[model samples]
Target: MVTLNLVIPCFNEQEVLPETTRRLLTLLDGLVANGAVDASSGIMYVDDGSHDCTWALIEAFHSRDPRVHGIKLSRNHGHQNALLAGLLSVEGDVLISLDADLQDDLAAIPRMMAEFRNGAEIVFGVRHRRDSDSFFKRVSARSYYRLLRRFGVNVLQDHADFRLMSRRVIEELRGFREVNLFLRGIVPLLGFRTAIVKYDRHARFAGESKYPLVKMIMLASDGVASFSTKPLQWSAYVGGVLALASLSFGIWALSIRLLTDRTVPGWASTVIPMYFLGGLQLLFLGVIGGYIAKIYAETKQRPRFIIERTL
Candidate 1:
């Protein structure tokens, strides 16, 4: 029997922790009893510095069943890094990542495992329909994926971080130590057999959504910057176009002055070009700053996350 490990990264999810653990344990037990997984199959929870009693609850669960283990980060490392920490610590034939919120269905684990048996190194649990989400969220999510693809980030169309990965795939993922971890983008780049299992995402059983719009936007931006140079290229292209436009405008102004002996002096003549040039300069600066920020972060050579305690 092959051992399977489920890596769940959680923050302030105390309200949902009990139910999430119960469901996962039931699923794992069923899998083991049915001979789908080895008796050693287990779940590992990584607590990302939750302010609530999330860590304590995980500890209680670990005490109740040795199949459940946990690691507590010293500080909040965000979701992606916490997931990475859990993945790196666990040893298993196959690994799966799920949210603590329980929005991602654990019932799909068996299906994901079956797909893994079919030779897929990575299996993404994609949401077929985000009916539980608000209209704004649904639209934003769709737009985010489209923008990612347009910017050259190879990510699954409707996949978040819920997925199964073979041990080898996990090892390869561990090689990526960048501070800004956009897992959706990085996982697809692993170049292995992959599959997707579609499921309807449910609303959170308890607590508010961890990923609000602002965080989602930040993640998307990080995904683009980490995986693609298209933004930098676009910056250069825009700068070039602006320079050309400036030259054209200068020529037109000079031509009018010489040919028609006309002096066109107004806010339109001065302010328009000034605004355009100023905006262009700011845009270039922003693009440059983005690249510089990443460079600065990398140069520090800090660990992606720090683990305070483990069980």
Candidate 2:
């Protein structure tokens, strides 16, 4: 049996940590008993600078069970960075990442391990169904995946961070030192022997979702900006098209004023084009600005996350 380290990223998840811990411990015990993983297999929870008693609870868990370990970050570096911190700072034959919210089904862990043992470098936990999500969420998520594909970015549609990575795969991942962390897009780029285990997603067990509407939008934007430059290309294409249209319109207006007496004396044509083209230019600038911001962040070479303490 090989050693497995389960990493979970937590942020203000005090309400759900106890239940999440209980379920994970039970699942780990079963895997060990079945000889799927060694007894040394343990769960590591990374506290993403929670404001409440999350770190305190994690410390208690660690004291209660040697199998339960914790890593406290110096500040809230977001979920991806915290997950990266746990993955990079652990000792095990294989590493698995999951969410602290219990929505990522724990039952899939064993299957992922099975695939890993079968010589797969990475085993992705893909969601079979999103019945638990709201209508808007389902629609938006579907659209997001489709948009990524349209942008020529390779990413598993229903997969988040629930995945198992072999030691070598994790080692390769460490070589990627980008500050704009987007693991979902980054993992697929690491080509290797891979497998997928499908499972149904569940609703949050407790507390409000850490990723509300604003955060979800920001994450989607980051995913796109980090992976593909298609947005920039498309914006340029749009500008070219609008420029040609503006030139044609100018020629037509000149013809009407010089060759004929058919000209409208109103702000409809002038103000309309001004607002429309102005809005398009601003939109293009925003897209370009987003990429520039990511470049700026990466160029700084700042630490993705800082560890406050560990147990």
Candidate 3:
């Protein structure tokens, strides 16, 4: 039988965790009884240093059930790192990484396992639709996927951190030593025989979203910076355009003075280009500085996360 383990990363999810646990345990029990998975198949919740009763609840569940396990980080190390901590700590035939809010449908788990049994090394739990999200979010998400692809980050559209991977695939993933971890982009690079399972994303059961707008922006920034260098290339393109424009303008002014013996004089003409060029220079500088900051971070070689406790 395929031994399955679910790795859930959570932050401040005390309100919805009990219901999440009850539903997952019931589903796991059914999967075991139906011979779809080994009886040893279980679920693990990685506590991302939530300042709440989240850890206490996980500990309570772990004491009552061997299937329920918990990994506590020293502090909130972000969702991706917490997911990695859970995934790297386990040794199951197949490891499924998901969120504790249960937004990614649990019903899709069985379908993912079926795909795995059929020889897929990786299975993505992709959203069939995002009707529940705000219209802005929906549009932005679609655009983000396309932009990533344009920049050569082969990511599955509408897929978040919900996915399944075989033991070998997970083992291979361990070789990724970069400090900035964008799992969606990194996993596809493994070049495994992958499959996608579509499901409708559910609304969060309770509590505020762990990923707010600020965090979402940071994720997109990291995704672009980590996977592609197109931003740097675009900077070069902008510089070339600005240089050509300056040369053309210089020639135009010089020709006017030589041919007509008159000068074009306007504060608007002078101040406008100054502001525009200044803004562009600052923008490109920020992009270059971003890359330098990332290099400095990687060179330091700090631990991605620290484990405070485990169960």
Candidate 4:
């Protein structure tokens, strides 16, 4: 019998939890009845320090169904860390992650499992189209994936956290110990047999998206920095280009002075190069500082998140 575990990391999702759980239970029941998964298959909900009745609801569900289990974090760790904590806790032959808001289609799970059985270690539930998103969001998402690929960050173009992972793939993912974990980038680096299932994404049922524009930018920056050293290399290339430009200017000034027999004195030309070089220096320093900050964070060896209680 194949044991399948569904891990949901929820933050203040009281409005959507009841419906999400009910739908998920129905899916699990169907899978068991059809013998696609063992009767012991279960759902594990990780409460990421929700202030609402999210934990209370999960506890109620657990009491009613022995197949339901949960973990409560001590504080509000971000979504990625919360998911990681849940993944670390569960033991299953195959693990699936879905949002508590139910934007991702539950109907796609069985198909994802079929792909997993077809020798795919990781199955991605990719969005075929995001018609529900605004124009700005659609453009930004496309740009994000393009930029990540250019910088050598391997990532699924239209995939979020919704996916299926075989237990062996999970074991490989455990080796990545970086403090800034961009799972979308890191997962592709595992080099496992992977497949994608296209599905139309739905709008959020309730509550605004937790990922605002600022948070999305931060995630993009983290993804670029964590997966590739191309940014640092680009900084070095830009510095070299600036140096060459300055040298060319110096040569031109000297040649004009020698050939035309005139001392060319101009504040505009000299001051412009000085300002440009100064700004370039600062930019390079900032790039180096970002990497230094990441190193400092890792050196501290702090726990990702604390678990206050479990129900």
The best candidate in terms of lDDT: 2
lDDT of 3 by residue, 27-100 (tens): 99989988999999888899998999999999999999999999999999999999999999987899999888
The local distance difference test score of model 1 is: 0.90
Where model 3 places Cα greater than 4 Å from the true spot, the runs are none
Estimate every model's Cα lDDT from 0 to 1: 0.90, 0.93, 0.92, 0.89
Answer with 2 or 3, whichever has the higher lDDT.
2
Pairs that clash in candidate 1: none
Residue pairs of candidate 4 with colliding backbone atoms: 74-308
Instruction: Give one digit per residue, the lDDT tens place, for model 4 in 205-245.
Output: 88767789999999999998888899899999988998898
Candidate 3 TM-score, C-alpha based: 0.98
Q: Give the number of the best model, judged by TM-score.
A: 3
Ranking by lDDT: 2, 3, 1, 4
What tens digits encode model 1's per-residue C-alpha lDDT throughout 1-311?
A: 78999999999999999998899889988999988899999999999999999999999999999999999999998999999999999999999999988889888889999999888999999989887878988898899889888998888888888999999998898888788788888898888999989988887899998888789888888998999998889988988998998899889989999999687878798898899789878988998899889989988989988999999
Q: Give each model a TM-score.
A: 0.97, 0.98, 0.98, 0.95
